[model samples]
Target: MDAYSGYNQIFMHPEDQAHTSFITDRGLYCYKVMPFGLKNAGATYQRLVNHLFAPLIGNTMEVYVDDMLVKSRTADQHIPNLSAMFTILKQYKMRLNPTKCAFGVASGKFLGFMISQRGIEANPEKIQAILDMTIPKTVKDIQSLTGRVAALTRFISKATDRCAPFFKALKGTKRNITWTAECETAFSELKEYMGRAPLLSTPEHGDILVVYLSVSASAVSSVLIRSKDNAEHPVHYVSKALQDAEVRYPDIEKLAFSLVVSARRLRPYFQAHTIHVLTNQPLRQVLQKPETSGRLVKWAIELGEFDIHYKPRPVMRGQAVADFLSEFTESQASAATQHITEPNPPLSQDQTPTKNTLDLTQPLWTLFVDGSSNAQGCGAGLVLVSPDKVALEYALRFNFQASNNEAEYEALLAGLRLAKEMDARQIQIFRDSQLVVHQVNQDFTAKDASMTAYLQHTRHLLATFHAHTIKQVPRSENSHADALARLASALEQGMGRHIHIEFLAQPSTQAPLICTIDHSPTWMDPILQFLQNQTLPANPAEARRVRHRSARYLIINGSLYKRGFSLPYLRCLTPEEGHYVLREIHEGICDPASKRLAPRQPRLLPCRRKTHFRGARHLLKLSAAKPNLQDTCRHHNGLHKVPHWNFVQSSHFHFPINKEQYLGKTKNHSPTFTVTLPELLLVTDLGIGERSAGTTPVSEA
Candidate 1:
């Protein structure tokens, strides 16, 4: 039952009520009862519930903050359970909303889910919200869809993997989304799945709960199960989209990640019962190793509290586990190659590569391309197999948001580019995206301007090969590439399973210049000379001095920089630049229009220092366009509020802070975050429009 004005039900301490008063035309007034804005209102209400329901909790009743439920084994006992709860409510002067509360109900919705003797199930309304919805066109629409999906993720299998395509749509700065074929297929499938969504079972005391872990290219999934009468039923499904460095984790790590996530989400289950992790991987050995990677040790420690045991998976016992097995099965040819549905028998022994060998001849290269863009993020996965049957897996993560179609084209483009780099003359491309294949073959007209551009670029790239053929196959046939795409699009979120995966900062549509007009030295030459050549000035004394100063020196974006004792990477400026900076620091007094400095008396030290310390950027703030800061601030706020983070934009920087901490910082650091601060800390702008020379990272001495 729902509480009546739950937070406001209790009276505040007489003296404290005055603190909550608001100003008005009338004399000051305060809340006699606890108000909604009280810092400890929720916690205080929870304490009251715990106190009142102490005996009934976990036996006949379950109370979560203001929401309470009474359960009984028999119909006759139901009345007594209700009476006992009501008796306590009366003693505490507690009230329930008559319209919100129900009596003698067989089943009902609570805490955004439906609970009953049949076990827990996702709310029908939540499922219908996605099903009844039209295709999402705006960023907000896609965001809304993702939000609904997140609420029901526990009921959905491989939830992160399945919804990957939507995340791709929200990537990058493109405001208008490209709703592609993959999204349409996924949308239909999601609705169909929701139409008959599985009923989640609850584990009974002493039940030996088993967890089946499944790790895909871009997601880690686990299903918590309990057996009854020799039949297995799912208690909960957990999924997480891996990002950044997490994507590079080994297979065992991914498995561990899945288990860790499951344990975290179902902490109560772990605390109460023993959990058997069913997997072929050596999870325990890795976690229990004397020495291991930092994250593994961290994950191991995180999972240390759980009563978890690892064991090899037995044969699939139920349809649900069977489904998990099917989605995550890898091919023999490439351990990294994941097929959504199991493929037919191997083509031949020649088609499989042996260790320590690759023959790049035969003039034929096979390409499988699949693109997934979902709420976790958008990415394209491609498996390029050379003539010798050696698979070269490339997962291209778009630096920006892309639609499914755009992602498909990206995968195809990336695959062709890789093959071209390998100097492959002939190619046979296989993709699950029918629209992209048909468009490339001129069978389907490129109706949209974006697709037309993509199709044109694809054709242009395909033309580089001596012979190339494109075919649209069933999704199952292209599962390997599809998995690769999902992995690529949602990279840095999880560890990579098989072969090494590479990320592309941008799409082929916005191709960068492959060749530059000239390659020459600039400000970086001195540092590069000192580091690489170990050469200093001709004079021995000056040379020794130059070598000494090079320790903290770094060349960033064609300019020299020094690692400041306190600051990070301070720009090393030339005399001319320093003069211009000093002038800009005196922006108000020094007129840029006049060639000579004004013959005016200088101000006192403190006043002059104040203006000087404000820096040139702050002084000239009115002249510079800082739409980036406003857009960035808005994006930052939107990111915190998003239920599911869309990794559509490939290179959104992730700081050490988590989402919760970020929100806290946002609130405390800047209540009015809309106003852009001065760009005092500028990224390198050497006046050179583009990079024209080879680059290397700065090494701190």
Candidate 2:
């Protein structure tokens, strides 16, 4: 009869019990009944069958519950052994679940584990149940669904923890019964993962496969299946929410749980195969060394069963992808396209009407240019438009080692050169780099030498035009020129000049830069104040070193380092160093009026020497009376409590006295005191005193 083991209990219905009793009363031999749902029912059943089949166990067959396996070196022996088991079951009036039972079938599943003539196989149907499950709408639904598949939870690494957010939302106290965006995202991802859960291959035919198991604080186990083909697949994915106590385990310990589960579950697969295990940790390294700690030694011994190969997370991704693909079938190919949807329809003409009517009222040409540079190379390009609404494109590539600023300057130069060639005087230059435009307009000075040279060249070129204006345009608005720049750079292979030429009608002026130079004292005061407040270091050694560095940077400023010492130079120093140098510079360079206003002393903390003692004994002792000494005194109290008087009295004492005291005997001393002190004579004892004494001594004859 079909029986499912439930916890430690064996249970049988009244009908089955009556059938078994009737058969026994009829004098027919029957195997003892261990009902399903009884505590230890499976174990008790197996033990009973083990005894009944003991004589035939190794000879030809073995039975576990309703399932029987007949194994022999020869097929001849296997057939008869199988028949004998069936005959015994018939005599016991017990029936096997035909659907659940298998005989002489090369492969079958029994007791939640797959069995084959070759070896045991991991059940993939269990993983399919998780994958095929619908998105759990409510927490109760999710729990109820997950509960039904709890036996298979071990196969799902880190089962509960990965689903914790979903679980938390289900609690009676939790609000927002609807799943959150995060919960939905996690839910969808889990469903996708379940859908892609792989079928673990049988570990027979000597083919090797490795199982990588990992765990996190929130999750219990993550199992990655890898075949010797070096292709990783998911044998079964399992994870559980860590219990309160498990969460306290250190990261490595928590992670080791996956390995523990995988090792136990996949034990049958590993016994006959040599598999290289992959783990998302250095468990292998920890295991290789002799375990120094009891816990580590225990973990190591558990992991020692398999050959392990540790892989970092980055390296594990490739294997994980392979495992991901193992679940794919021909039918699921169409599902991959769900991520990419059809394109939007074209907009109606009225939605975006053309505004290309030419404006001949003011005849002017506008040029938009852009530039870019990286360590590899630099490029510049420009799109010129005529008053007739036509666009002219030009781009150039420079092979020199230049910064983005220089590339921009060159792009401006190229546009200016193009405008001059086109003989378009009173032209407007539009550029994405604000720095380049400002520097060209003389509103900002060119900071770099290369840019300065380009700026000079640009000014000289601009001089050719009767009237010219440069305006900064945002990068987004300068895409036409940007594309040309990238194209120009891509066309040129090496360090050489390359150019592109195209044509277009320019659009009307979008924005304009109005240049107004006023000789107002408002602007000069800040500049003058900044220069007057500059300072240099007082230490000649430090000053000289800074001066040498400044000399290299100051050549462009056109003055010696000492004369040109300014705030800009000090800006390069770190905050603390910059403050100190600025203070020194202000003290030395500032006018007397400014000098008086500066802080008299530099605002910096004084340096203090720290004393460190090597051992605890070298620390200072503290009295109980001092508040500052409380910690030390409190500890000392334990060490220096009052000694027990009884113990002190039991201990022996040693004391020393001077010889003169014993020898000084008074004339008034009584006979009692003399007798107590021992007899003292004028003649000295040789051993006790000097050799002049004629008295016998203890050491002398």
The local lDDT score (0 to 100) that residue 539 gets in candidate 2 is 66
- Residue-level lDDT of model 1, residues 104-212, one tens digit each, is 8889888989998999989988888888999888989988988998999888988887789999878845688878899989888888888889989988888889988
**Candidate No. with top TM-score:** 1
Candidate 2, residues 1-701, lDDT tens digits: the string is 24233222334555656544434555864224444454566676777567666778756775666456666656677678777776765665545556555555655666677656544444667656666677666656767665745755544435565466676667654434666787677767666655643345434355656555544435555564545466555555555566787666655555566566656766765554555555434554443222223454465555544444454443544434443222212432344233222221323433321122323343578899987776545677788999888998687767555567767777787787777767575577778888887777667986766666676667766666555567777788889999887776555454354354332211111125679756434212322322233233566454334323332222112222222222233212223443344334333343222223223222211221132211112222212233433342233333322333211122352111444433443223443544543343333222211255444332211
Per-prediction backbone clash count: 37, 45
**Per-prediction TM-score, please?**
0.48, 0.35
Best by lDDT: 1
